[model samples]
Target chain A: MRPGISKILAACAAWGDKTAFLDCSGASLSFAQLHELSLRLGTAFRHMLKGATGRPIAVVADRSVRCIPVLLGAALSGSFYVPLDGSLPEARRRAMLAAIQPELVVGLAEGTSEAGFRYISVDELYGTLPDADELPPVDGDMPLYGIFTSGSTGFSKLVLKSYAALMSFIKAYIETFGFSERDVLGSQIPFSFDASTKDLYTPLACGASTLIIDKGYFAQPGRLAELLRDQRVTSIVWVPSALSMLSRFGVLGHISLPDLKRVLFVGEQMPVRQLNIWREALPDALFANLYGVSENAGNCLYHVVEKSYGEDERIPLGKPFPGTQVLLLDEAGAIIPPDQPDLQGELCIGGEILALSYYNDPEATASKFVPGPPGVGRIYHTGDLARYDEAGDLVFCSRRDHQIKLHGYRIELGDIECAALACPGVDAACCLFDPGKKKLTLCYAGASGEAALRTHLKGALPAYMAPGSLVRLEKMPLNANGKTDRVALARRYCGGGDVP
Target chain B: MIESNAMKEQIISILQDILPGEDVTESTTLADDGRIDSLAVVELVTEFSIAFDVEIPFSDLVNENFNSAEAMEAMILRLQQGT
Candidate 1:
């Protein structure tokens, strides 16, 4: 057996009957029960895999205690698990499954009969107890999981993570956070997001309990706070948007969480204004701002918020983790001199925890995973513009791509453009956010207004993707790269100029 | 009774203030019509709980119980009766 797998099993055995997972249905699994379930599930998964090498297993379960054992069972069976969020569109889910060509799909839903794959329901997997000796040893170098990133260039790319990389990240997280048996970790991140890997696995690896938060609670902040206090949750990893909503509605002010020890916020830019509220509310807890892309398993840089930062300063991305190296590089891929701290450059990450590659997409893998300086190995080009401040902390500037973060959702402008083009009478369209007004505007070349366009967009896109306003345009400006001049468009639409 | 109709009007006004769009009446469903989201529901429930001095569990804050101004008022009255 692999060392990491052995260690995980040993920890589960040592923890014995202590509670390991709690679902929204009030179902709790002790460590011993979880271990036994995982072993049986692993045996069943191995039988299903039938000795296929590097096969992808798709898991379509909602947030539940069973998700952990299923994911771990897939890993133990030497199969990479691909978590598909049930909330996504069926067409998008089909596109992902078609791209990955998963060998096995496990879900609780009924209508998942796709050709060329074996579908096993959670009920069947849990009911069938196979012999423990049938479980095959998993390889550390084999792929453990694949998380899909909202691809900017048309198609979603699956970032493949190896077992060794996952173990390395887990080790780093435990060392930094000091997780133990007494801690009850709250998980709010979707399984598809890389943030869940930290929230779900790190606790189990350290013999701590994991509290699974229901999706409904996140949408409703009052219930979420109640759950936090009721569960006696000691830690949580969430995006900044959730924190912003909690503060804006005064939920934190109304409810007191006395057991929360650590709060890690990631996925988007952390607003200092909101962070201050959380710090004041949970004065004794540690607040960390983590920065990383899906290409690096989870987080590579973390900034622990101290009590002294006078609320006005923007939080830095802080230094790299123990096994990670962060390099600021120019457009030509050369490292910027350390003395020149003011120069903005793309932040590149190099470490053992770097993801394997973009699954089935060699072209993208080559483009993103480039060779670093001699002997530094492969590094992921994050495409994020940042610079080292005078205090040697990395400060984010903006994204090089056409990605815009509205509220808390990551929306690619191209996706919005594609959706708009599908609308009737829309020849071409460009969507850009007006930060000053907090409104997203769509300028189309053909015809535009709130009536026909809103109806068209409502059918094509999600509720949040619909533009708050629409403007008529003659043509979109193009730059030297032949791409839409987003900067000029932002200035023209947002600067209060007359529409054509 | 300190004007039951006035209390209903006040609750509707508060709901309109919290939720931006959509008309709110005694019969309007809070969950439907997109008038109140999860966060808004929590805020509204907290405001009602504090104003009425009732301990309302989060699980009870559902569409069936507090879907409308009248329903919420009835819930508050029941809690008052219990006390």
Candidate 2:
């Protein structure tokens, strides 16, 4: 059996009547209750799969009490789970579901079904029991879950995580952070993203209680503050945008969350201005900046915010966890010496925390997960550019590709350009990222109105992935090689100028 | 306050510029029609705050106020008058 799920099962036995998960409406599932329901549901899954292999079970992972047990049940059935975003556009969600081609879709209701997949409602899964005597066996190396991330090539990619990789990271995380049963976690991220894995599994690993917050609360900062204050939520792992929203809305000045202790932000750079607002309000809380990718099983490095920072200054990635190795490689693939500290390199993560592989995409997997030079485990070549700062902290510089992180969501410039080209009356388009302004711009040479292109792009992409600004030019500038001159576009259209 | 029609036209122009292809009108449902998402909402708030010279606090950010350009115009007028 996989050690992580077993650890969770043991927590269920130990915690007994204590609440394991709670939703926004005060609906909850106790540890014992979750364990019992999941095992029975898992048995039903095993029977449904009939010992099928390599087919993932997709769950519409909404922020509700029902989703937790279904995810756990998928693991118990000796199958991995892929969490689909309930809030995404149907076209986008359909594209993701089609990419996975799941064996079964465990949805909230019965009417939801994709072609060639068996559909089972959460209620139906809960009601049925397997005829088998025991649950299916789980191997540690088997995939635990698959998450969808933005692909530079216009489509989404499925990143598969193994039971061993995630569980090992969880153990290392718990040991490094000193998490325990006394903590109450308020989860901020949706389960569809790998970032939510920390919130989903940490409670079980440390015998803690998790308050699964409502996504709607984010739109209302006052309500979110009240939930944190009332729930006495001691710890929270959130994206910088969430924290910045709360800070920008002055949520801290209106309410005081005395019980809040640990504040962790990941997925994007936490602007020091927003960090200062949070730090000034909650002086006692431990603030940490976490850095990692979905392929690295959550964060491999974290930096405890020890000193004050300027508003525009970039925060360091700090240090890696005990079991992880963060190495930098130069342009020629040579290891940049740690002592030099001046050379920039692609951030390569070396550790067991690396994911198993991209699901069914060996070519893409081989390009990233390469063998380490001498006696080291395989390293994940993160396309992120980085360099060690004077303080010896790993600081992020820029992306080697056109990949950009806005509001903690990854977006590829080419992805936006592809969606833009699909719009009627659009011919040529180029996407640019302005790091100074921290905004995305799309310049196109198309007859379609800017509003038309925005609407078309919105239908194809999520809100975060959409360009913040659009520019129309009579003709897109091109280089001698006939490629769109992206640098010239960035130089001209990057000052938040009027769209023309 | 600025002329009601002029303000509405300006708001439509802003929406058209930001959104690109929507048939935004005085009564178009911005939020319901998915023309204005969360990120777009932020852009709208910033544009309104700058153009109207009024602070559009998050508390005032509701679908009712932003569902239509007319609602946004009324909101701007109210905030402008209060100031």
Candidate 3:
């Protein structure tokens, strides 16, 4: 590995005045400015940490140009940066901050600041700093960013990713796709999401410019289409839901994005219905399916959609990205042979793209990321089940646990259950996802009504994690194991049977 | 244009069908509020077209137009007028 950071920052000098980032709010940062600003900001962070390195620095991530520098700057501080969604319910952000116990929080709202941690504005971090040569060398193994993923426990697990993992993944991705300095990437994923790493770094790596579309525009697909067309965005890697919304509303029929060259979707399965719509509209663009987990470096597998599939056929996870290795493990922890077609096993990955560890959670880290053979690094057991097809392509079967992906967000059904149980009137809560409807319904034997439970959940969980609907049960059914009979509850309330 | 009670009631009923939670009323905040996600917004746009026979234009699909049942009623009426 190229020691990641020095090469990335040093290569920027040639791009000079090229636009590195452009926000929907009309803010733009050039490559030279981004290079200088991050170093200055890094110097400020060093001062805040009293010269201590490898500390976690929290950035109040909003969808804006300014937040980009903060992300890069935090890494330049010799510490890992954790992007916290500022718009999340204050309680949700609080719990994450408490888990990380960051050295300083950048751009946190004044009134919301906790006393134990120091807070600083993004503007304040732009101070004069040491030259690039003066800074200490950082190895590829050094932690770069920490991403929070849903945990079975109500608290999210912070996955600490190293510089080598991110750089290796980005290098393989942009190179395979042929991203160049002239390309403009349409960025849709939020800063806090691990998938967004590709956007943040791809532009920096290849001297491309990523134009961030406003979050609200997804609700109004026409505006989103307009932004892409007008800005001449050539490439985009987004969650399936955002792309589906455009086709669902017939927004594509009204607009034309002739500039778009390639479109990649990840996080969740993309229904063939919407994919067909996009393929018809942009006949020249490339459509690809990607598979990844928060525990890995954004993504590990990808398959470019070669032939149009029928609505009934599922998209294959395709092949592993360059520099990454994916394997299947049977229940007994034995590696499944690639020749065994149609034999299902839990998908596991090993290579340079694997993350360092789940921060502050040794048990989770140990259980999920088992040690790999001598030089392969640790292997990540993705909790997702898959099998090799006749063509040697990986086919996604189903999730092994209650964790589900909705609208590209990974959600633990147990995480919602844990939060529901925290409510005063809620008792014996079970959350179920009706995959047919793409909705989460929480069944509970509780004193509170739907409105009250919704209010409680709104405060406790992020909007995306909150159950779409609520059901009241006299009491939860119990199985022979003495656990809540989730199957029975799901059938009674969410199936053809009436909720009552 | 004034938001008629019938149109407002239609919008609420349509939203309730898609979201199916607590009762939606004229004052319910739909757009920015966490209650309605992006997928739900697309469904609402489709539902409005079927119910009112008016295609919501790209320019009129902003949050202000869908923030509440009353707001959607007004926007529907505006689109219905060929504006």
Query: Which of the numbered candidates is closest to the native, going by highest TM-score?
Result: 2
For A1-500, candidate 2 gives per-residue lDDT tens digits of 54646446655557888888899977998888888877878888887888775578999877888899899888888788999877766776777778788888888866777666677888877667643246656777788899876453334688998878887888888888888888889998889888889888887777788999876666556667888999999999998867866786677987899999999998866757678889999999999999998787878989999889864356888788878888888888788766778688889898878898888899989997899867777998888888887777888766677667777886667557766766755656788877666788888864578899888888888888788899976556643212355656766888532211
Worst 10 residues of 3 chain A by lDDT: A474-483
Query: lDDT: which is higher, 2 or 3?
Result: 3
Candidate 1 per-residue lDDT over residues A316-415, each given as its tens digit: 7887888987899998778886568889788999988899999988998999898998778899888787788777778776566656677889675655
Candidate 1 segments exceeding 4 Å error? A1-7, A110-117, A307-313, A337-339, A402-500, B1-83
- Candidate 3, which segments miss by more than 4 Å at Cα? A108-112, A129-134, A152-155, A373-377, A402-500, B1-3, B10-37, B46-59, B78-83
Considering only chain B, report the TM-score of each candidate against the true chain B. 0.76, 0.87, 0.81
Error of 3 at A15 (Å): 0.6
Model 2: CA > 4 A from native:
A1-4, A130-133, A402-500, B12-38, B62-74
> Which of the two, 1 or 2, has more TM-score?
2
**Tens digits of per-residue lDDT for model 3 on B1-83?**
43477777777777777666645674456677645656556566656765787776666767787777778777788788875
Show the lowest summed lDDT stretch of 10 residues, model 2 chain A: A474-483
Candidate 2: residue A23 Cα off by (Å): 1.6
